[model samples]
Target chain A: MTLSPEELKNFLIELIRTAETRLPVDVYEALKQAYEVEDNPIAKQHLGAILRNSELAAKLGKPICQDTGTPVFYAEMGADFPLRSEFYDIAREAVREATKLVPLRPNAVDPFKKKNTGDNTGRFVPWFEVEIVPGSDLKVTFVAKGGGSEAPSTLRMGLPIRGVRNVWETVLQAIVEAGPKPCPPVIVGVGVAALSDQAMALAKRAALLRPIGDRHPDPEIARLEEEMLKAVNELGIGVHGFGGKVTALDLHIEYAHRHPATYAVAVATNCWAMRRATGYITSEGKWEIISKHITG
Target chain B: MTNVYHLRTPLSEKDVRKLRVGDTVYLSGLIFTARDAAHRKILDLINHGEKLPFDPRGLAVYHVGPVVRRKNGEWEVIAAGPTTSARLEPVEHEFIAKTGVRMIIGKGGMGAKTAEACKKYGAVYAVFTGGAAVLAAQAIKRVVDVYWLDELGIPEAVWLFEVEEFGPLTVTIDATGKNLYDEILERAKRKAQEILSRLS
Candidate 1:
């Protein structure tokens, strides 16, 4: 049976609102760790305040940070999904209502004019990527990516010989150079593959992975994550780059087939506040909360 | 009593040398706001030998693109945080020399050339607190006068604000080659390496 438009719209709005209000569990863990290791009194104090703010926001159902961020939606719809025809439009409407109900900060600005739309919806807003698989359920992931971390996100073109070592060095340089601007301690998502753009996209996708500290299915990638995390923290760009032992809470890498001569690496840094919400819609048009970390 | 100093409208080399790095000074004076585009315009004007809207000598320039508010038919500043100053590094020296400005107020630190020019010209670079836009607005008592650069837009225009006791910024880049930001970064880097080694 086809899902009612109103029900789908409400789910989308709820997802966006929750994404804006809550800092993901992994991001919260990273920030707490950063606060623990921060040496600079001022930076440490700032991190504490941010942590408290996040807690208060979650408790009171308020936006975690002032920069509500641009809404990003990722959908995996089953081939048998009944709402497939109207999914995209429902997502857009949800974002529009979310802009008002959530009171999300007006982040979408006209590139050339630099004028804010004030509703967080503009060209290509609620950016969505849809995948169709054989199933009767629909999976929707909503992420509100902030500008602070996005500003320092990097894509590098590495020589074939450089391989993972080059990826490590480049990420180290990015974190070192980023200092406190990207709002550390940060969770770094690394995308490795043949194309820079696709790799960058995959890096963002990796950000949504569950925060299973020190656990990786791939031993090599897992080892690389551990090594990179240690190296990055050692940079002493501690909490907010204020000089600390814990600069990164964790590192997640997503890999793809690459061209023999090209090693495309993309690093997307997620701030202490990684706002994300995910849910699944079953074939019967019933919503199932797969993973909800809003109260944290 | 509030510390008030009737400094000249535009500060000069001699004026700048008299001030220290951490001194809080009330500039009841005329100052201009210019970031990327306005700096370009100022440079072009200098190149073309055209007259500037305001005199540059001994003047203080704030690096800000304020979110303007309107109330009762008058425009006012709501939040006027300092933008990252390094973006204007390429044009700072030229703007300083040609305009003969004495002081630069911004957030974060500026480049070496700008610091050098400030030292040579007897100027100073001050840093207002980053993310403290609301507090900064309270110091701006009035608009006094405004020259709206209608074309270049809010951030890149030359905004002339009449401020009263408008500062609590530290001297990150002083007149005598003492750069506090550089020192902080270096110390942080060393400490970072030490922390990393311990972890490894």
Candidate 2:
């Protein structure tokens, strides 16, 4: 059976609502753990406040952050899925509806005109990147990219001769410069090896995709993730950039093979409120929203 | 050491002068909101010899563009979290000097100039935990008025609010010219250099 356009739009609308209001369970748990162990009194209080804020937003049915963020959707659809032609339109429609219903701050502006779109829908907004999979099901991950976190993302080309350590150094420098700006304790997503644009994209996706505390499958990458997290936490930036024991809740590193000439490194940071959610649409058009902490 | 303060708005040099880096302050009474556009507009109004919509002496300016929802014909704050203050660095020193704003609330550290202005103007730079929008909104008692809503739009408008215990704000830059961020980054840079050397 083909997925109806109306069903797809409604599913996406619900998906946006849940993603905005709820903090994923895993993210919340990591934050709680950080709050429990944080030695600095100032940092500890900040964490407590964050947890309380999330609880309040959920209870009141409000957007978790005032900056509801730009809704970025990543979708994977089975090639056999019949709605390929209409999917993009439905996604944009869902976002427009969510902006009104959730009353998302009108965030989209015409860059050149400097005009607020009023509906949070503008040129190329509700950006979607799709990958066609081999299956018959549709999976979508929604990332609400906040201005504060996105402000600190960086892309740089490290000299090939300098090797992987250069990538690490760059990532460290970026995080240090970002210091308390991207909001802490933040999750760092490092994307290595791809070209500049692709590397940044991968880093952003990694920031939103990987569950907090989950490491890369490859042992080497996993080891790097562990090392980076330790180094970052040691920076003493702490929660909200006030000095603390836990500067970062976790570090995620994802890599792609690159041209032999350059090793491009990109770091994407997400604030303590890791605002993301994943939804699946079945062939029968059933909508399933999964936030690992909330559902799993 | 950290100190907690229950300070009211229309703050004086004496009130802000006592605040030091790392001190926690819960600001009460009136606070105004402004972002990039509102900042520029205020500057323009000052230049054109027009009176500001609100009094600036001893005012606490929060750098935010809040999401406000209308309920029962009145505006209610949905999420009123702080925005990055660094973006205001270009004009902030002048803003403080010209307007006499005694306290600045936002996330991210302001620059050296702003810190210097804080000292010279007897002001303080405080950080409200970023992303704690819902929590921040609860402190706001009500929206008193707004300016430049049609001109600069909702998020960029200058919104005046009466608030109570409106912060878990850390005074990152205190009136005595001490900046918490500068100190933290100094130690951070030194420590980072040591780590990088070991790695290399």
Candidate 3:
């Protein structure tokens, strides 16, 4: 049976609602682990409250955090997938519906007009990044980025010889400077690319898309993730900047082959809420919401 | 060292004065919402000596744009969490001096001006965990009133809310003009320098 457009729109709506109202399994587990391991009274109490707040949010089916987030989707579709052409329109409709149905806070503002669009959609809203790959199914990942966390986004350019140190400086500085603002115990995403915009996008995806504990496939990159995570936690920015052992839940790095002339680095973070969902529709029309997290 | 305080609105200087950085405070009473737009609007009204739609004296103001819905002709708060507080640092001291608001509740850290204002005006700057919207909504017992919804939009509107047990808020800037974030972040910056030195 062919997958209907209505079905796809409705599925995206579910995905958006799931992302906004519920914490994913991986993120929830990481937070639970953080809470269990924390020793400082200030950090412990704050983490406990975060856990409690998340529980209440899921129980009430409310958006995990008020900034329900700017809607961004990453789609990997098979060349043979039937809905490739319709994905954009379908997502726009879905986001518009979800903005009201999930009751997302209107986040899209016309920069020049300085007015909120009322709906979450504006010129390029519910942004989608698509990849046509070899497969028979379509997988879409939705990330809802909050404004508070987005405020700390950083981008810098330096000589290629300085790439390694630049990466280190940019990521660490962003996190430290953010202190308790981007919401502590954040997930830091660092992107290195030839171009500034590409670096920024990659950094955002790394910070917001990757699972909390999942390491990059490249062992070298994975080691970098582990190293940064350690150094970040050691900074003692703590939960809500109260000063503790855990400042960031995890650190991730994503990079593209850079030009010989330049090294552009970008850094971003996601608040502890980790609002995102991944779903796929098989050629046979079977759908699954694969993002992990379950309430205990 | 951490202490816990439960304070009701129309707070006296003594109420917040007793609060120190790292102390937790729970507020029960009226607090208003104001982001960049609303704060500027309030400042403009204050400068012109025009009456504010709602009184701010002795109460708290939140830096947030909550997710709300209208049901049965009433506003329902779906999620309400603190936004970054640093954005308001430039004008917050003036806001404090003019309004006499005893509490400034938000996340992130405010600058020296806010700290001095807290000291001068007998108020404190507290942090409500960022992204804990549902918890904030639970504390909101009712949407008491709203202003400038048309001009500033939902996110920027001045929303007066009646709340109870509304905290777990940690004082980052105390009435003594001490700032927890500055200390914590400064130490972290130094430690980071140490680590970065070793790593390189």
Candidate 4:
């Protein structure tokens, strides 16, 4: 059955508003852990304040950090879904309204002019990466990606010989260099594939899929994630890069077949305020809230 | 009560020399906001032997791009958090020398050349609190004037703020070669290693 535009729009608005204010469960857990291990009294104290802030924000239904971030939606639509056109348009409209309602710090600025749109919509805002599945339902994941962590994201083009060790080393170096800049303890997403841009995309996609502290399916990747975690924390760029044992809360790696001669590695860091939410729309046009973490 | 110093209009080498690390300075008068892009443009002007938009000598340059709020046709600063100062390392020394800026206010620590410039030029680099945007905004009582570099964009333009008491910053890179950020970073590294070993 076709979904009513109003129903879809309401759901989209709720999702956007919720994503604006809340920290995802996984991100909250990582921040808590970072607070426990932080050694520098000042940094540790600040982290504690941040934790309290997150908790309060979640409870109050307020945006966790000042930078509410650009709204991004990843949709898994079914071939049988009747209201395909209505879905995307509803989502975009919801984002535009939510930008003002949530008072989300207007992040989308005119890239060339660097002027704030004040509505958080500019060129290519609310980026959607869509995939069609077999079922008669649609699953959409909304991510509020912040700028602080996004600034330090890196992509490295390496020879095939570089292998996993190269990836580990490169990641560690990147984290060490990033130091307090990205506002750790961060969630690092590693994308490995043949194409550099594709790999970077995969890395970001990986960030949305995994829960905080979850490991990769492959034992090798899981092990590397652990090792890299330890190495990065060793840099002593603790919570907020002050000094701590929890520089990274989780490392999610997404890999694809690489060209025989080349390996492209991409790293995306998600800050402490990992604002993300997910919802599923069924064939009957009713939206199911799979997960939500909405703060004031 | 916190000691408040009313520093003069254009701070010179002599004025900067009197300042000490860890001393709180309540700068009145004029200061310019110059981040990555503005720095590049200012350096280009210096390179071309062209007149700069503002006098640099005895000037305080803040490394910030504030989110502005407009009310009744006047622009007010909302949150003016300091941008990463290290990004300006490429042309910091030259910018300081050519511009004759006496003080640099930013978050995080700058590099050795900046420290060297501060030492040689008798200037100081003050570090405002990172992530404390609201507090920074309070320091800005009014926007005296703005020279919009419309072509360069939000981050590129040098916006001048008339600050009431614009600082509670630690002098990380002082005129005497004492680098607080380096000390903090080194200590953090050692402490982090110890904690990581336990976790592993």
User: Candidate 2: where is the Cα deviation over 4 Å?
Assistant: A293-296
In model 1, how large is the Cα lDDT of residue B177? 51
- Which has the higher lDDT value, candidate number 3 or candidate number 4? 3
For residues B1-200, what per-residue lDDT tens digits would candidate 2 score against the true structure?
47999999899999999999989999999999989999899988998999997897888999999999889989999899999999999999989999899999999889999989999989999999899999999999999999989999999999999999998998999998888888888888777877788886
TM agreement with the true structure for every prediction: 0.70, 0.97, 0.97, 0.75
Candidate 1 RMSD to the correct structure: 6.3
Candidate number achieving the greatest lDDT relative to the actual structure:
3
- lDDT preference between candidates 2 and 4, better one: 2
TM-score of 3: 0.97
Assess the local accuracy of residue B194 in candidate 3 as a C-alpha lDDT between 0 and 100: 88
- Model 3 lDDT tens row, B19-128: 99989998999999999999999999999989998789999999999988999999998889998889998999999999889999998879999999999989999989
- Compared with the true structure, what per-residue lDDT tens digits does model 1 show for residues A103-209? 55556778898766656678998688889999988899888887667788888999889667657656776776666666666778888999989889988877555
Screening candidate 3 with a backbone cut-off below 3 angstroms (N, C-alpha, C), the clashing residue pairs are: A24-A293, A25-A292, A25-A293
Instruction: Tell me the RMSD of model 2 versus the true structure.
Output: 1.5
Candidate 1 chain B: 10-residue stretch with minimal lDDT:
B1-10
Off by over 4 Å in 4: A6-10, A52-70, A86-90, A104-123, A134-137, A281-296, B1-33, B37-62, B71-80, B94-108, B122-171, B178-200
Better of 1 and 3 by TM-score: 3
Higher-TM-score candidate of 1 and 4: 4
What is candidate 4's lDDT per residue for B71-108, written digit by digit as tens? 79997665565666788888888888888888898755
Q: For every candidate structure, what is the RMSD over all alpha carbons to the true structure, in angstroms?
A: 6.3, 1.5, 1.3, 5.3
